[model samples]
Target: MFSPRACEGDTNPVLIPFLLAAAAAAAAPPAAMRLDYFHTGDAREERFALDAVVREGPWPGPPDRRLDDTGLGRYQFEVRDAKSGEPLYSRGFASIYGEWETTPEARDRARGFQESVRFPEPEALVTVTIKKRDARGVFQPAWSVTVDPAGPAVDRRPPPAIKVWAVMKNGEPADKVDLLLLGDGYTVAEMDKWHRDAKRLADTLFAVSPFREHRARFNVWAADTPSEESGVSRPSDGVYRRTALGTTYDAFGSERY
Candidate 1:
């Protein structure tokens, strides 16, 4: 017999609040956005000159590298509240490619000395607060960074010291040309090796006739330490991260070197 049968079901009811919550969460706006800096290449300067001289045993480094029009890149961010925009806390870091230059011995020597390493102020910080308002608008965080005026915190860690020398084509004073010498931290033995390497680097420059002929006219110096206690690095989760070094670069690349 093909008779229709009645189905039995539970009497418990579903909660309306739970279903609404699920819908709200699914419709909420995205929280993160990305910015690129590759288009800004004219801001950096040529800080190194191979044709400079090394008169003094070691030379002092420049105050800091300045940012120019080509230094920065596109940026974007989202903020929840302007009133609560203050930073809960902040920190930074710096580093030199130990592999960028210097021989193994010098790299070892540079590990010993601890000194001040200067960096551009205003690396980046929260400035403007982007939020959802009465009008249709995108939320973006305004930010800025600066070098601390207090100076480098003396490193108590037993690390190496690094030395840098610049040799120009014509013997000229160090102040005559713009230069920037960067370093990574090291051990005591590494400091000694770095000093020796500094001399070696100078000698290598002189080996070239153009620099050799102008050797007497050039100047030489060393940075007592790395750029800062934290060492140089871009802001975390920042738009300027890739743009600051390689992307927005104004000068000094494989083609130039």
Candidate 2:
């Protein structure tokens, strides 16, 4: 299991804990919940298995925006009230396996990828369903599982030794779009550089037209992992290095995907 970010290390950090505490005391919003699972198979077939359910932190997204009606991505997941079958939360997301299955490699061998879905923690039991696009692009149920919000199976452990800071703060997270900046290939010595890189990335993002115009509607957050290496693995160039977060280039034969 990967250690959580919002991880340890920074002291007296601003905003996050405040929101968590407020949500705990009042009916502000539900805490964020994450579902981790293994997606396995090849181009011809597929399978899913539950891995773990974790309490990440306070939910940052808008409570009212529960359903993703855009019908995007190759896959979609829905969380519903177990008894009434009322859809509580839903989202469409693209996965690494979604692309991996289309590759020629999938035709030769089977592969598995660890994937996760995050939703607001429900009050009681909720049935989660994952839908997949068919040949005609119609979304259909592929997997379903039931999760209890107060179940002992939920992992409530503290995060790892990491540092979190806000690059840009715009009101509360629920009222704004929250952007998370996570580094994979960076060592303890490169923390300052990572900080600079995060700011630069945020700047780059806001330099665009829409994001620049609506800057106040977004909150940018950054986390430092302090891996053993300074650069991610580039398997295409015959270079490999181990890091805390395993991110690499040459994915799906793309250099910078």
Each prediction's whole-model lDDT (CA)? 0.32, 0.90
lDDT of 2 at 124: 92
- Most TM-score-accurate candidate: 2
Please provide, for model 2 over 27-57, each residue's C-alpha lDDT reduced to its tens digit, 9 standing for 90 to 100: 6667899999999999999999999999987
Q: Mark the regions of model 1 whose C-alpha exceeds 4 Å error after superposition.
A: 1-181, 226-257
- For candidate 2, the lDDT comes to 0.90
Cα error, residue 44 of model 1, in Å, equals 18
| Best candidate according to lDDT | 2
**Angstrom error at residue 16, model 2:** 28
